[model samples]
Each structure stands twice: as structure tokens, then as C-alpha cells.
Target: MGWSLSLLPPPEPELLDAVFLSAGRALHLANAFENKCQYVLRIANLASAFDEDPALTLDEAIAAAPSDKMLGQTLHLLVDRFQTPVPEEAVGLLNKARAARNFIAHEGASLGSSYIWVARADTLIRHAVALRAAVQALSLGDCIVSRWVSEIEEPNVPAPRSWDDDYPPMVDTWVFGHFNGLLEG
Candidate 1:
């Protein structure tokens, strides 16, 4: 005869809260990284296509690049098609981040159930924190690439609006500081 197992107790509210917070941050950072990749690819495409088709507008150029591709494919295009020079370290970080993002997207919920059932809330939180770190590092690399793109296209691009003008004081400060820190490194 097979033995029956009792259901485990629910996870602590605080542990659940931590997991949610970290998971949210990881997902947010992953999205931001994807956006940066799209921007880089679109701008690079514009730079090349504009000379050949003077009538091409930014919107047209952006539309020309496929947006449905996965992150790995997007990275490959940036390097191979656009000849964007990503540093070796940045490439490693991007790969790591991509893996983390994919895992969280595809299996996080399923794995989370197991962790919760086993009362491994700390492990779940740690996993989320690691994913967030990887994505955050990837974002820094994206920022560097963005800076490079801006420098190359400085003459064509207009001045950016001040952060303070668009965001509340607290948000503006945090935004400014976060970007400044990323760019500085």
C-alpha cells in the first residue's frame, strides 16, 4: 500500500511578500533590458537604412525591425547584423540574464509551488534575488550600448527632456540617480 502525505502549511505572509517583491523587480528589469535591446536594434537599422532610403522615417525604420524575436535572437542580430560592439563581459551578463529571464518566465510559477509546498520560502526568495541581479547587470550593459548609440547618432537625435520635468520629485531623483549610476559604471 502507498502512503498518503499531508498537505504542507502555507508560507508566511512576509516570505510571500519578499518573493513577490523580488519577482516583480526581476520581471521589470527583464522588460527594461528587452526595451533597450529593441531601441538599439531600431536605431542601428535606422542609421543604415536612412542613407539608402532618404525618405525613411524613424517610425518606418523601427517598424522594419522585427519585434517578436526572442532575447537571444535579438542579441545575435545586434552583434551580427548591426555590428554592434558588445564587450565580452557584457555578452556574458546578457547571456546570464537571458537564461534567468527565460527560467522565471517559463518555470517560475511551477517551481514556486514546489518551494512553497516544501516550506522553502528562503530558497524562493533567493532565486528571485539572483534573477533580479542578473537582469540588473544586463540593464547596465544595455545602458552602455545605448550611450554608444546616442553618441554615434548625436547629431540626428534631439535633446532628451529633463527627468525632473516628467516625474515626481522622488521618482525623478531615483530615476536620475539610477541612470547616472548605470552610465557611470
Candidate 2:
């Protein structure tokens, strides 16, 4: 028989909000990388084809390149094709981003009924920073795709309107301070 883990309880609302936002941001980064990967591969392929035969068209090059792959596969192709060092850490961060996105979009209600991911706000912040690092690592000095990267601003980590005076509670001061330091650093 297969073993399984049981669910517990939902996390605090603020914690949930923070995770959802961070994961959503990471997902945005993931989408940008995915789109840029395809764009880069097509451009490179077209350039090479042009070098070989000037008759090749952009559409032909784009259709010829194997662009119908998943994001992870595209990242792998980047390494082999461009010799870029997308570290394993970066890949892990992307995967984390994807998982977080899936959880927020698909399993959000379920998350409210379980405690499997009772992570603190700082954890999400760290993940955001890691995603940025991954993007930085993948970018090239003079590549068109590098220029296609969608810039992400720092986390605002606050409600657009307002929260109650007791928001986040004074108990979370250490966490807020530590995460703020990570962002500043």
C-alpha cells in the first residue's frame, strides 16, 4: 500500500496573502523566461539559417526550431545552444515558482483546509529574490532575448488600501526585519 500524509488547518490570512502574491510574481517571471527562451531560440536559428542560406525567412526559422517544449526543457536547451550557465539553483527556483503558482491558482481553496505549506512570509520573500537571481544568471550581455526580460520591481509587501492597526502583529517584527534586510541586500 502507498503511504500518504494528512492535512491539518489553514494558515493565517496574511501569511496566505503573502505567499499568493510572491508565488504570483514568480509565475510572472517564469512566463517571461518561457516566452524569451522561445524568442531567443528562434532568433539564433534564423541567424544561423541566414548564414547558411539567405533565403530562409523568420517564420521558417521559427517554425523549424523545436519551440514546442515545456519551460524546463527550454531552459535546458538554452544551456546547450548558448552555453549559458543557468545554475541548478535557478532551475529549482523556477520549479518552486511553478509549484507555488499551481497551488495558488488551482489549489488555493484546498490550501485553506491544509497546513502542508505553513511557510512564513520571509520564506516567500527569499523565493522571490531567488527567482530574480535566476533571471540575472540566464541573461546574456548582448542577446535579444536578454533584452526581452520583463523587469520585476521589489516586493511592496503591503496592502494597497490598509490593514488593521494590529496587522501582522508585533510578534512578526523579527521576520519583517530579516526579510527587509534580504530585499535591501
Query: What's the lDDT for all of these models?
Result: 0.55, 0.45
What are the models' TM-scores?
0.60, 0.44
Candidate 1 error regions (>4 Å) = 1-9, 55-68, 81-84, 107-118, 136-140, 145-185
lDDT of 1 by residue, 26-122 (tens): 5655566677776776666667777668798788876675555677887777776555566777677667656755765555434343545454655
Q: Best by lDDT, which number? A: 1
| Residue-pair clashes, model 1 | 0
Model 1 accuracy (lDDT, Cα): 0.55
Q: Residue 105, candidate 2: how far off, in angstroms?
A: 9.8
Strongest candidate by TM-score: 1
